[model samples]
Target chain A: MTGALAAAAGGGCHIFSGCGFPAPGLQDFIWTPFFTIGQFQFTKPMLLAILSALVVIGFFWAAFRKPKLIPGRTQSLGEMAILAVRDQILRPSLGRKGDSYLPFLVSLFFFIYIMNVMELIPVFQFPVTSRIGFVWPMVFTVYFLYLYLGFMHQGAWGYLRNMIPAGVPWPIYIILVPVELLRFFIFQPFTLGVRLFGNMFAGHLLLTIFTLATWYLLSLSVGLLYAVGSFALAIFVFVLETLVTLLQAFIFTTLTATYIASSVEPAH
Target chain B: MSVRDRSGRDTSVEAESRALGLNIGWTVFSYLLSGMAAYGLIGWLIGRAVRVEILFPVGMLVGLAISLGFVIWRFGKRGITREETSR
Candidate 1:
């Protein structure tokens, strides 16, 4: 669909060429790195991701640096954000026992949220999370943390036993073992990364399609009517995408907390 | 664990529970998909070596059944117990 859209979008330029619509596609996703040092290429997504991390760090620092009994405006906003995540997202999945992980969860939520919010910003229209390159590493770290927690809390063999459950007949063990193994080992992290990437990628594509269509269809005749409709849809889609971005960030953070909760108390 | 909406109009315990239920459903679906893909691939290879086409589908079915059983064990009503459900 994206490829087709890109081809059609390209046709918009020719007008008289009666060509296809020039929409965004897989090619638009592939970026030329701003610079390369050896094998490492610094791309736009990389810059956005780094900026997101810095933004999160800077915000928290400014919010908490004073340690005031009565927080000012910035500090109050920061406290609300932290408290909201704690009560709504983490507390539900993890409870007070998991309070130690609050910092990690807060950081993950804010960083992903900021990266997702970049889509609506004028200069940075592309969402960093839309890039799988940015998502996999974060997911991998969460994966590793959960695994470590599982091993630490459950003991080595205990973790495996907890994962398998018990009382299954020996004959059924063959199928059950592999299913359990693959589900926990691969699917959890894979889905985690893919969920964030897929939401952002699809939302970005939808916005691009509507916006491009509005531009391409803006001729003087009947095209103007179509353009108006397209423009309205574009605005509607853009508004929907903001909610999507926020929801995806929340869901990702919630799931991370859930995974940690399960890992820490595998039997539960 | 209770969180009021931004409007401060209503607590979201019900909504949060629904979200958790949906999260469990998604996890179950992923388990089924991964299980089938894993064993099905193995079965396909064996079937090719043995010149049999039936094992691939057989593998897929077996994988689905195993994952379903796992999901039941992990998420059945009995699995959560009273303590977790209340939370």
Candidate 2:
């Protein structure tokens, strides 16, 4: 709500205050910290990220606290959530052997979904995952876990052997080695975090633009039609945001599973 | 084993997972991008030292080619398929 667009449209049409369409930029996304302790500062997105994790953890705790063989309503719901993730996400990449990681995968899927949905949520309309600090932890966790799994399952030499593809010829190693190293070490995690960040950042910005435009365009006379149009676009963007929130979460979790799968065995 | 997508239609989990794996196309793209940036910079510096401006683009092209080949070798050669897994 503190966006440049909102700031520009503040109160009403301002002739002296220089009223025009203000483009949303990094300034709009920066949140002033609520408090600071020494060099550490606590910000809103950080709170939201923590809250997202707590909500996922709390929900699962409450849902599965009292397990029933016959399955109560809460138990059934919890079971369904887990089963959906396992079937759609884990099973796809890791297959049946991946059952051991069901808990981790379920937590990841829901946490990301919750954080993403926050952008649409009232009062807390910000996708915390839009920040690199929030996304990189997830990426690095996946990066380290998969790397550990890779080395563990394949050993040092075997892992390296499997990583650099066979039959590329010794002459091509000059080029391929750097490419492969950069791909794995740098871009793999970089893309993982950036893809999530980019989607959420863009989504939040567009939603702000449309919503702010709708507010700014509101008038009793000629501007009425433009206000309506902007409002309609805002609604359309909200619907699209719903799909993006879910899709981004699914993609992130699926990629994590695939990384685990690739690391644990010979990747073709 | 059938899995439902967002639409609730039944889909083979094997085929679905394979399809989903292709979502990693972004990883390939970023790999190519980083490859070009890092190696191209190195090539440019070398070119500057050697007085050949053309080496920069050549280095970028080589980096792109290497990343492309890596992608082809990594993702293109094989994937989890129902027919093959059934065997």
Candidate 3:
């Protein structure tokens, strides 16, 4: 029995023939560095980020460059969405003072939405936001704006006091002060980065897993069942990812307005 | 000039002007400084957690939440109606 099994194993019956699946390994899982210029090296994620930005810019440019008075279908839809962000999210949360911050907020909202939507594109089927390098710059931009606004409005002492708030009992100051400090210094930025990262990362991973599963099962005896299941899951996640892409973008922009509003409020 | 009018007008105008300046200044300053710090911290954390520096995008989200909470807490407390009215 052992000899027979050994002979059969050596008979060249590959377990995963014609599966069209990239083998699981570092080469398959790791993204390659595209090239290096001077000290800087560009990778897949970096390329994706650039592509995502260009796609977003191009799409909006085309959509709004030639505005129609009566409105074409695409332009009308685009205009309505931008108007919604301005009216519903920005104005209400930031108030009249929010007008100045509108451009920044709008850019952030659309850029993020496009980057997230990259997961659905055929050849560019990767969400650039899933990469941390791209996210840090964007996150930091907002973080810096917040800090600048806070200090600019209030002097050092005023800013510190502004943080502590008023009306808490004297005893509670001890508890609240540290908590507030932590929230400002640590929590805010962390949440912004993680929330977007987690969602995109999970979405991309799910899509990849289903796609690979579909391929793998298609090579087996009961492959049809796995393929169908994988296809269904992939489609479901694709739709979900689309919603998440937009929702995350909206959340990020809304929070930015809220932060700006908080810093700009008059100090008692 | 009447003492009441002179003192009330001068003090209210001064306070309002100061408040406006402070609001604009603090808003910009806090956003920039905290934004940079948060960005750096999130990048560091993501590199540490995921063993990948490119994972910084994931960290941005974490940083955003933390920083926003801080900014709100720090600034929100300053909105004391009593203090403003008293001034």
Candidate 4:
């Protein structure tokens, strides 16, 4: 009887065989282009990034194409959200003179938000941001902008001075200088990239595992508990992942604004 | 010190002191909690997936290392002054 029950429980394992682990060898998690004429061999992540960009542009274009006098539903909703980020997050952090950087902040916010939301889509289940290649480009973009703006506003020396906090003792400068340098040049972009990458990577992995577990456990009589547990965890994680998708985008945009603001303001 | 100068300095000093405390506390707390939660979750999941104890801590360390790298980089650069320096 015990053996029979175990056999019945193990029956469901066949349903989850293919979906358990990531793909094997070079093809694992990577989508290679079928046709490559020259040196340009497009990968899955790159294609997804491009798609994300187009979707962002398309959404805004459609919503703002025809402006109403009083403002229509979609246009008004979109415009209001954009304006809120501008006024509440960017403006306050950046101050009055920082208005010029609004376009970049807006674009970054929507671009990231759209890419994040891609994970929830039916066919495009994988988020492009989960891949390091896609994340590196975005991180570098922010890094270059911050460096450029800092130099433009304060010049080289001024930008350096902006980094060191005032009122430290002379002897402490030795330790503080190197720490500051490491933070600005190396740490900022690294963290920004890792934060997004880590969150999305972990979230997707959890979803995959739970999904497979759910299927595997449903195969036998004694497996009902496992199936139920897996299902519950999967649903819980899905909701959290959705919230994280939005939160990450917000955090990235806010940090960009803060970085820009720091560049423009005089040292205290 | 004179009374007026002492009072003015005291107010500004108190404000700066408060801000510094708040910033430090907030940063430490936020990173610590998030780090713990992330590592715990990853460790649990990996243990379940592979059915191995080694992978649990290994996964936790990997996650921790990544998060630490980020926090250090983001906050470390704030102290540098980027203005032109005389040769």
Query: How does model 4 score on DockQ?
Result: 0.04
Could you give candidate 1's per-residue lDDT for residues A1-268 as a string of tens digits?
A: 1354445545444333465467677776776789999999888788888888999999999999997898899999999999888877777666667789999999999999999999899877889999898899889999999899989988888888777555667777776777778878988788989989999999988888888777777776687788899899999989998899889898888888878877787564
TM-score of each model, paired residue for residue: 0.87, 0.87, 0.66, 0.70
- Candidate 3 per-residue C-alpha lDDT over A26-129 given as tens digits, one digit per residue, 9 for 90 to 100: 23324656788998877766777777678767767877999988988778877877776676556645545567787787778888888888889987777888
Q: Please say which candidate is ahead in lDDT: 1 or 3.
A: 1
What is candidate 2's lDDT per residue for A156-263, written digit by digit as tens? Answer: 777776666556678877666666677777888888889999999999889988887776666676667887998999999999999999999988888887778777
Docking class of 2: acceptable
What DockQ, on C-alphas, does every prediction get?
0.29, 0.26, 0.04, 0.04
lDDT of 4 by residue, A102-219 (tens): 7788888888877877878777766778777777887899888878878987899988966755655677455345445655676666677788888887787677667656766675
Better of 3 and 4 by TM-score: 4
Interface RMSD, one decimal, each candidate: 5.9, 6.4, 12.3, 11.0
Task: Point to the candidate with the largest DockQ.
Answer: 1
**What are the clashing pairs of model 2?**
none
Error of 1 at A207 (Å): 0.7
Ten-residue stretch with the least lDDT total in model 4 chain A: A19-28
Question: What is the C-alpha lDDT profile of model 4 across B1-87, one tens digit per residue?
Answer: 111132222123333333233334334344444454456466778788878777666655655564465446444555422221100
Off by over 4 Å in 1: A1-19, A166-171, B1-12, B15-19, B69-87
Model 2 CA lDDT for position A182: 72
* Most accurate candidate by lDDT: 1
